[model samples]
Target: MEAALSLPATLVAKLIEDAERHGMSVDEYCRAILSESRAGDRSSAQAAVINEPSLDDLKLEQLSVERLSLTAVGRTFESGALSGHINRLLPLKIGCRVLWSLLSDEGVGPTIREFREEMWSRVGSLRDYLRMIDEDYARPRGDRLHASFPNSSDAAIKRFLNQYIIRKSGLNAEQSSGAMIDFGLIGISDTGRVQFTEVGRNFSLLSNPVLDEEDHRGPSLSADEQVLILSQIRTEMMREWKFMRHVLDGIHVGSNTPTSLLARINRRYGPGTKADWSASVMPHMRSGVLGRMQALGLVKRTFIENRVEYRVTPLALVILEADVV
Candidate 1:
């Protein structure tokens, strides 16, 4: 049996917050609370716990199930999307958070025009971002700025990657989306919106303005933090990439080129791939797989016995042997 009682806006908001905190639905939370109540009321011992006050100044209006304000949604969305912790990882595109929020909802996500307006509001023009990038590159570093140690120069590079967008060519939405798809971070939903892969969602959120700035900027995060970011990146890469580990392993076990590496892989799998190497499948293994790994300091291309060969980097070896805690 059940009954309905319209809750005050304040109480409903609190209930929603508490439900989310405990990973419970509103009905479940309310049922639990009722179950805990002795005869529908707290005992004398529990009476000390403050009861909900009827404060006129609190804007305690009746709950409206039909419509909730955008500010309310924004508050909930930004609580996770724009939080400081997430803002330090990847330099997210301006509307990335908005895109994510919309995706989290049921219906269709925001249209391209709506997304572009948000971008324009946040960043006036393309040159504005370029100028910010210029500023970032110009910031004085290590010994030069007398900020800290020398060899580790101040460099934080994340060029505002758009998760999914449709804008002018200057935004490079298509190219950015292509790179993300190649990296296996996102996929196209049936509704034509970007959807985060499992590891992609777990990676970490990032704000546009100060994103990746923590890698350098005014106050750098601790070494543990820095390594954590890299570790997460590596984990996500491994989760999505099919050929990276294989290619790296082949290199470690003395396979120079794709033909040689493919031969090695064929030993584990059936035969055929070595003889039937196609660009569509392998797709520039050296530049595509190994090169992306190189960006993460995972592998290096060097001349071995007068032949260009890929070698696993020290960072990759360290991660393989022992991941940093």
Candidate 2:
């Protein structure tokens, strides 16, 4: 009966996110929440959804069809599938830079407390923003961890912390951004400071470059930095990510285009496997799977007549030949 209801997409996304957070399948999560709601207090049960919109609300501009661009967020219903909240948004070089910032100070870069307060603090005050701004402005312009906030107001800075940071890096709620941690690069120390693991230390050496506003390229990866960046695609992307090998296989088998590769993955996924999120996988593959591979020289990407295609690199072919799978 519940399956018949399309339900609010937002709620559906939240359900999957909560399920992933608890290391449960969507069905398992729903059952657990329902059992809890039935057995204990109804208010706190994770299953209890409130304030559904009415038909009139559906007609509102916010929920209108014209704003349907956000329907592609990855929804992981299966446990431990290719569904982690890695930085699907940022390119690998910027990610390296982010890691470098955390590895800057000796034994203490950005503390988890500071990250949590910046990313998700309800007690955020103007004084806090001003203090942070003063601290940041104290440093050289491009040398600040966060892009300097001298010109932006408190509210603007807060919004940037939530929206821009969330979109660019991802809400850490853990290590400033769960992206680095998921990629097996960074972790939190006993002192609650954001620190690099053995892998991240290697990544930091090259990522720390002189990036300044004089170079509007703050958001873009510069050529010199790209040359400086280490090749973690074969190591981390393929080693850590379960989805990369399959994407490599797809490219090798002539499923080179994004659309074709996506179709192949959805078609090949099985019931017992951990990858049942095919319904919401495109967003993850763009940069997360394909882009990283291309950036790290594992694949070649080209656009022809509005269609982008990828071809496996010689290095990637070597990995494919060596792979037993």
Candidate 3:
């Protein structure tokens, strides 16, 4: 004999009523309820079992030493890439996007979703607006649009618009009318198509808080100052020229300091100490002197063997060369 089924008549009646309301049969409703109960139970059990990190935890992890080191180097290179010239001015928009992308990606490849979400958080929907701008004024390329300003990825463009343009302009008005009009960044034609005026392009490029001239102060050091600094650097390098060269040539092909390699130099050139060398050079090198060289792309640092190692950059070779030998 079949086992007796159990269910309250009132509950069955209520289920039937709900099923009728939704136009589902009693059998269908029961199946759905059972499936839903199982799903809910699974979800609750999973919630209890898994110990997922919160956004804050993720953020903290992102800020750890390993992440920070990569971020620092990536940011340095990103800035270098955008500016092209070491001392050239970068608009606020460009700067913000560059920084946000670097931080979000944590020095890895670009994340378009994170960038898009960042844009949506700041502005409504950047896609349609960007498309409109591209259709009206920009020339389309392979996967990007070229406007009067530099060509960049959509995420890059959106971040630039959000942090630099919208925030700086303080445009919080309705999407179609107030902000764009008040800021004079966009216009609607009689046919209702968005048209970019010359003034709009000029404002976007020059007036946008992100890419304005204020942040970029051109070259920080003059040619004469550069010459003086390079002279000092060369003088210091000459003291250990043969030693450094030998170290460079013989060093293991990886991120490593010259110490192990410099053993060769010590053997050939005698016992010279980095501490003594630094002490001697530190007096002649003023504060911000190394920073100036970095800005000029003359030197860079690498982390190897849990320590920082400095080396001359490619640009330094051109700048530091003697006439012949």
**Best by the TM-score measure:** 2
lDDT of 1 by residue, 128-151 (tens): 433444465575321121211112
Q: lDDT, candidate 3, residue 60? A: 19
**What shift in Å separates residue 304 of candidate 3 from its native position after superposition?**
1.2
Among all windows of 10 consecutive residues in model 3, the one with the lowest summed lDDT is 72-81
Q: Global CA lDDT of candidate 3, please?
A: 0.36
- Give the candidates in order of lDDT, highest first: 2, 1, 3
Cα lDDT, model 3, residue 271: 29
lDDT of 3 by residue, 1-325 (tens): 9999889999889999999998999999889989999999999989865633112211212233232222211001111011111111122223233323334223332233343345444332223333444455432331121221223466656544442333222232223322223223333333332333333333222232112221112232334334433443344334323323333343323323435434443444442544332333332221122333443445455666777565676655564353222
State the lDDT of candidate 2 residue by residue for 1-325, as single tens digits.
4666677999999999999999999999999988987777765454443432111211122122222211111111122322332322232333334433333323444655454344333223322332454364464332232332223456754544443232224444342434444444556555555555555544443322222322322322334433333234334444343466777888898998877887776765633345445465555644455644554456777778978788998867887898665
TM-score computed on alpha carbons, candidate 2:
0.47
Point out where model 1 deviates above 4 Å: 1-108, 111-199, 204-210, 214-242, 256-275, 279-283, 301-309, 318-325
Candidate 2, run of 10 with poorest lDDT: 68-77
Please say which candidate is ahead in TM-score: 1 or 2.
2
